[model samples]
Target: MGSSARLRLYMNDNGPLILDGGLATELEAQGAKLQGDPLWSARLLHTNPQAIRDAHHRFLLSGADVITTATYQASITGFIDHLDVSCERARELLMSGVHLAKETAETFVCDARPAGQRCPLVAGSVGPYGAFLHNGSEYTGAYAQEMSIEEFKVWHRPQIDCLAAAGADLLAFETIPSIKEAEALIELLREFPNSQAWLSFSCKDGTCISDGSSFSEAVQMANRCTQLVAVGVNCCSPALVEPLLQSARSLLSPDMSWVVYPNSGEDWDSEQGWLTSEKTSASISELGHTWMKQGAALIGGCCRIGPAHIAELRRELKGSCTSPSSAV
Candidate 1:
């Protein structure tokens, strides 16, 4: 199906669609070591592809209606610099992420036959440039000052091209920190008129995006882009989702949907590991309802949230809040 048709089918549903949680965290849970790799989960595309597929399958069984690819931190430039692979090989790795997710979704559909489940779609994850830097700048939007629109487009186009050519259902421009990057991505989407995507930002607060731009401005910018199917926040604090959605709703067109996938409310120090936060103390499943109530049409988890969290969210959304499978 085309991207627009697939998105419309879900948007027209009675409730929000469930997206998969953190790909890297799930990979870690399965014993894939990703500590110092700049590519993060994307590196697994080269060393352990089956593990990537396994992660996707787990999310599918957990009732995720959409599964994002492991290409979030993968970039052609990063591959050339870090992995020292040829450009052709780098593109191959990017395409591999799409195929793995696609194959996993197809296999799950044929085997499970779950009730009320539409065929899950694959969203090619297009993470922020700061992600490529591995400096925690993705959470800060601090890279905007050094990056220009042309540079941003040049940096992002190849990844977008590879993902689109690989036949992903939609592009997920996720964890976007600045309005400049959002605009650059929207411009790049024009290079492929048939492509559709969702623009999700990393917010510093309930009302402001990571770069200190108002959510209203970001939503308004997205509203002008024809190829963007939805716009909202991701990789931010769960506590801020409600107000972010409210801000988006106030600025977005009625036809546009909103997506929310926040972290486990933990603060990540580059030196130390994840620190717990009282603000994120509520279970992700509990937060799902509130996000939906605030007009989020797609909901999922981000950092530190794993398959079990997704399973609980699925059960909660399906109105069957029983125990999820231990396999999760």
Candidate 2:
């Protein structure tokens, strides 16, 4: 894996890319109560490391080509209030997530029951500042008076650098809601010489993110960075993602790749706070089929989409994409 050789694989790969989700809460379902941290994101890190492996393995079994590490909310800044986990310790947990995924994929390939099929790739997942800030607001002026981009660079450098060191095949900056924030990360990504990455936004009305930037604008900004392999929408309601995909296809270059992984639905209640309704998954899969026809390169489930939803997507994908020309 020399620099030039690795860079070539990142830039030239053509075909559908599969990304997996459901690590934090999914780990909870597997009997791990990650308590002790008020920061919701760090809890997953405190949980059994094996829980991280199992959730990713489920996605791999469901046919995902790329498995994302469970490090979305595993930030040192997010857990400073907690006395138990130090910044360094929290970061190691995040890096461990990446290591576990890559190691798991290697294990699967080596122990393949049917030897011929290949295993999935590992994708390092990065989340926002534990809040709902958009790209522009993420870093600009007085809001972060206590911290500068240099400080952020110091905090995130370890997490991102560790992922690079842990053998992540790609980096997935997901659920990004603003062009400003996306650009901030794009700038950091340029520092990584040969690593491939994807940027995904969470839209509101199909055209605008929660911060109010047009979806097309987000694509234009992301495209400015040459290292980006794909731009997409994730963590928004299923209804919003469809029109966003359609709008995105019209603006993006056909040679570029597209990915979509919408939430089950928008409604949330006490019992299932932020959970996607069961019916939404089936409908989202139906919409995913149409998106595949329009130019989406990859498809999968995000929040609330369990194995059953992935099963539906896989089944639909069988007939949804028939020719390479149809995939964008």
Candidate 3:
């Protein structure tokens, strides 16, 4: 079956899908210094790809049904400007990010998972345009003012082409902060007619996407996009998810599923990393059940969230989340 068909089949048998937690958080735990690096996790795609694979493996063992690639901050222009590579070399780096994640997922299933169950899917991580700016513009979407939808599409196409050609099962247009960008993505998906994807916005609160557009309208727009398998929030405060879904509940098409992976309730700094003062407010183990009730079939964490948190989510929902003897 195709990946989308397999998605339906898996959900029918597996209840809800458990997505992996933050890549940068896991990378840092494994000794990556990412602060001030424009590439963030994508840097590891070129310098330490084994680390990216290791992080994905940990999430799979922790009960993730889907693991996204390390290309979240990757873009052709960003790679060229920061990595000092030609456009062709930039494409190779983006492709490597997907290969690493795909390799990890395939190896994990072949070696450790059971024979009859569905193996985890690898999602190509496509962050918003602002992420390439290396600022907090991803949260505010202030950059949208500088680019038209056509321009936005132009900026994003190269990365999408590279990722889709690299063999990811799906694309994650994640942490988007504006409805304009989301609409641009909706149009862009039509160009890649056979690809499957999910669009997730970064919210300022429960009711509005970061650009202050009506999220209800965003959801309604996403409802019309056939290429999208899911739509919801990501990298926002966990407290905001309940109301965000609640607001969109009445309008959502039954065909469109929800996919959410909020942050660990920690604040961010463009100059510094996640602040140290925030207490552990993830409570993903407890809140994940609530989100599932809100139609979030795919759930996980973002910044400051790690493998242990994901394991707790699994143990809470699945009874046993990993193979005791499995090594990754």
Best by lDDT: 1
TM-score of each: 0.95, 0.81, 0.95
Give the TM-score ranking, best first. 3, 1, 2
C-alpha lDDT of candidate 3 relative to the true structure: 0.87
Count backbone overlaps in model 3: 0
lDDT of 3 at 315: 75
> What lDDT score goes with residue 59 in model 2?
67
Better model by lDDT, 1 or 2?
Answer: 1
Measured on C-alpha atoms, candidate 2 has an lDDT of 0.64
* Clash list (residue pairs), candidate 2: 135-180, 135-181
- Flag regions of model 2 displaced more than 4 Å: 1-15, 34-42, 79-83, 113-116, 131-155, 269-272, 275-282, 319-328
lDDT of each: 0.87, 0.64, 0.87
Worst 10 residues of 3 by lDDT: 319-328
RMSD of each: 2.1, 5.9, 1.7
In the range 1-328, model 3's lDDT, one tens digit per residue, is 8877876776666557888999999999989998789999999877888899899988887888889999999999888999899999999999998898888888987888643446898889999998998888999999898889999899899999999999888899999998888889889989998788989999998899999997899999999998888999999888889999999899989888888899888888756666755465647788888888888888888888888888898778666677445433
If ranked by lDDT, best first, what sequence of candidates would result?
1, 3, 2
